[model samples]
Target: MTLAEDEALAAAPDTPDDALIRLLSHRSWQVRWNAAQNRGASDAVRLAALATGDKDLAAAVGQLGDALSSTVLEAVFEHPKRDGREQLGCIAHDRTTQERLASDPDLKVRASLAGNNEDVPEDLVRKLAADRRAEVRACVACRHALPEDLVITLASDRSALVRWWLIFTRNTREVAELLRDDPDEVVRDQARGVLGEPPD
Candidate 1:
């Protein structure tokens, strides 16, 4: 571990809040993460400043769940820094956070939100089914909580990979319809595997 990392580890909750805030500017990403994790609200505000100032720092701050608040999370989600958006989308846990991530212009950010099993709205999961990135679509297909209609729609996605994911994992009767007209042979095979019958 680097000196920054060591300093960060030292600035746990037991440490004075001021000391932890100062450590937010540490050169090491690990140290920043530690500071963000251990700091109080005031310190977290200070750390957010550092996080928003630099993409690397923002990424580190994103890893610090202990210091996170709905306010700070909103700021991170809206930060001009792209890297921060990726990390923020991964860790944010509230309705506001999910909304921001679902609407993010970056597909990776949206995908990260979809991958998070908690707090994702059903509407957002449906939107993710049409994401340009296959990874995002795959995440949507894997989300078992998605409404049955959304799952059925995703089961016919153009990407065979996404279609196969729904076909094999989803047991909804609605999914059986996709098998009847699946364009991808592999997806058709997977759909057949689920129903124990060949496609027409």
Candidate 2:
């Protein structure tokens, strides 16, 4: 079938669920992609879309937001396919899904979860702050409104990058004295900015 015709079939509201499912495997990625994004697409179609591992199509499906069932969203988050899982971690709003992703083996996925998800549980926030990967810890350090205790812990973190973010994201005036002599020169300079001292 012609590209336009294929897309029309994929996107037609009247397209049967089974047919849409079949189109998900059509040779043209656009046809399959259109089928994936069809408003009429079913939970089954959404799950199939993630399994296809086409990053763009998976992203389009993610944009469907609340139109997507929790089961469908969970499937993508837990899918063996890694195509768009990191992006999913960044924007996931469902608490259960966010918790599941918090322990994902991929550091990028966990880091994304830490850097975004405004409603992330405080327990998870603490967990990410101490995460072995500096990148994950760095993300936690960069979040605002962190507890003062967490800020102190981050200020003492071994990774200069994590300490850098702590100073970068928080109002340094509150912790200026703590960070003023940090070993990382850039971090010290940032702390100085808060204290009105020159970067020596």
Candidate 3:
């Protein structure tokens, strides 16, 4: 395979899974690395990454994030390759998986759990809402269909960024009213923008 073709294979976001599987074993590490990073990479790719023992490639499996099934994620957490833990939190549906990741030291991991999964349990959502980090709380704010009490609570969040995301959820009338006079100008402006829009 030519370097140019390898580079093209590496860079193309839409590279098919079969091609990616082939590239995972290709002679060129660069092509392999790109295949690992592609969004289309699948559980098979992750399994291959695990087998290859290339830490960076294994870590790139994080890009698959919410796309991964619990079975594969179990493999990821079991593996020592630690870099991708951040994105793996997205698909953590199992209570044990959520519990393991919920208290992880890394905020990116917690934030991914907070924002990425539609099926994330309400209890976990509550825990993430109260996270000390604004980044994690902001991710919670971006979630749709939060419990009503949470809408009110996040509307008054100490972090302006959290409140800003709350405004964008467009979940309740109270959100606009609570933030219309917010101390943060950007939040106030966003609140104004959504004032007349119907709540979702």
Candidate 4:
């Protein structure tokens, strides 16, 4: 690792807030990201300053993630800046932030929102299930917290991998009937295994 990388890793969570705040302006993006993550609430003011001034989008987003309250996130989410909204959405847990991400013009950002699973709303999960990207849809399929109806929809997806993943999840019964004639043999095998039937 480079000297900068070593310094970033050496900075601990308990390090003085101002020291961490100073590191946020380090030339290395990795150091700035690490410093932002370590700042927590103590460095919120410094983070808010960076969120508005940092030229690097990732660094700005990282600063927003470390903000003391949803206040900084809310500010960045509505900032006319436009460049960092997607990255901000990737970390912001507030419902309004999530709603904006769900409808973002960028599919990758929408996919990032879907991938979070924990704070993303069920309606958004359902919407992402129909996304053209298999990776995004797979995220929704493998989300254990998703409602049974959403799981059932994903279980019937054309992607065999998605169906197979759903077979191993808790709500297998919801899609048991749908998988009886799955086009992929491996998926059918998994469904049968989950249903306790002898494998073919």
Candidate 5:
């Protein structure tokens, strides 16, 4: 942070205006950050810096006016970096992006999309309810607006945990009686609690 270091950052690099872009590949995050903040930086410069997995520079890129558009979000989901792909399902407002991420091949990312209720597509959620992965089905059980039929489907999910997650949902009354005989003792116990006391 000394004047000498500031001057070093300001000095022209051999690569024309590409100095800021090239600095994004530097070994030190400090150098990459200083370049990200350079007044003359371009979107190309910022995006290159963002793709580096530097949290601060990524935050800076996210603050840009056009950040998080569907295409950019898609690229983030497609990127080789884990941090970028992990951010895919967290985007709430863009239905196009949400739909794209919902079909992602990665099970973890699909589970994240399964749980998002805001502006999320119902068809996509329903499709996710049938995902081969029990973890994704468990997340579908956690969604607030699920259809009653889907709730029943989850009630019988092969994974005990997936079936157990359905206990927190309220509209499973039609299936609650069947769950009384569930092979899993904990699921049977949860079904009793969800159904309350039987007629005396």
Candidate 6:
């Protein structure tokens, strides 16, 4: 093994199941991604790594193919830490958790839940599509699975920034075409540019 590989193994979680955790704090992105694809890694490690919210770390961990249990996932969402809001958002695709947090009295949690894409509850996302807060609704717009109709609606949102981001979603075709005549020159210009070809 190379010297860097040894250092990463040193950084790996030291639980009794450390071997199964497959922590991805490695020097190499490819190594981290490869580890996440390691079938031997346990669900606990995948969830824990995802909770850490590292860019490359999460890219690796979030792509893990292992099945997550409600017990492990619940612990991740309920962990009493300042980062709880961020962590819960990462895994909010969990139907039960997404639904529970959709109405969380805390606006931060509600907004946080808007960022997850996987396993997203359709109704919650639809509801958040028209959230009272522009920021929250913007988060829903950033979603990969946001409904096509919501994209069209948010294209006309009061927030220009929210309208600006709709250009990135696959659901943006109609919205982009519709925004071609928006009063905001930037939105109109971008929408016209996007109308040049179908969204990828």
lDDT of each: 0.68, 0.82, 0.77, 0.63, 0.66, 0.62
Per-residue alpha-carbon lDDT of candidate 1 for residues 115-161, written as tens digits (9 for 90 to 100):
76456667777777878889899878877577767876786677888
lDDT of 2 by residue, 140-186 (tens): 98786588899899999999999888888874587878899999999
Judged by lDDT against the true structure, how good is candidate 5? 0.66
Ranking by TM-score: 2, 1, 3, 5, 4, 6
The true-versus-predicted C-alpha distance at residue 74 of model 3, in Å, is 6.3
Most TM-score-accurate candidate: 2
Stretch of 10 with least lDDT, candidate 6 = 59-68
How much lDDT does candidate 4 score?
0.63
Please give, for residues 29-89, the per-residue lDDT of candidate 3 as tens digits.
Answer: 7878788776666677668776677766766676565566777777777766555676567
Q: Cα deviation in Å at residue 56, candidate 2?
A: 2.8
Clashing pairs in 2: none
- The TM-score values for the models, in the order shown, are 0.70, 0.78, 0.67, 0.62, 0.66, 0.56
Q: In model 5, which residue pairs have backbone atoms overlapping below 3 Å?
A: none
TM-score attained by model 1 = 0.70
* TM-score between model 3 and native: 0.67
Better of 1 and 4 by lDDT: 1
Candidate 5 lDDT over residue span 68-161, tens digit each = 5545544455555544444446555466666766777888778877875445678888888888899888988888887778877887889988
| Model 4 Cα lDDT, one tens digit per residue, 1-200 | 68565465525666666666666666676666666556442546344445646645333553354343666555555555544565654566667667777777766667666765367777777878888877677766666587767776787787887777677654355576678568888878777776777667
- Steric clashes per prediction: 0, 0, 0, 0, 0, 0
Off by more than 4 A, model 5: 1-42, 54-67, 169-175, 196-200
Any idea what lDDT model 3 has? 0.77
Badly placed stretches (over 4 Å) of model 4 are 1-30, 38-60, 63-91, 171-174
> lDDT (0-100) at residue 55 of candidate 2?
75
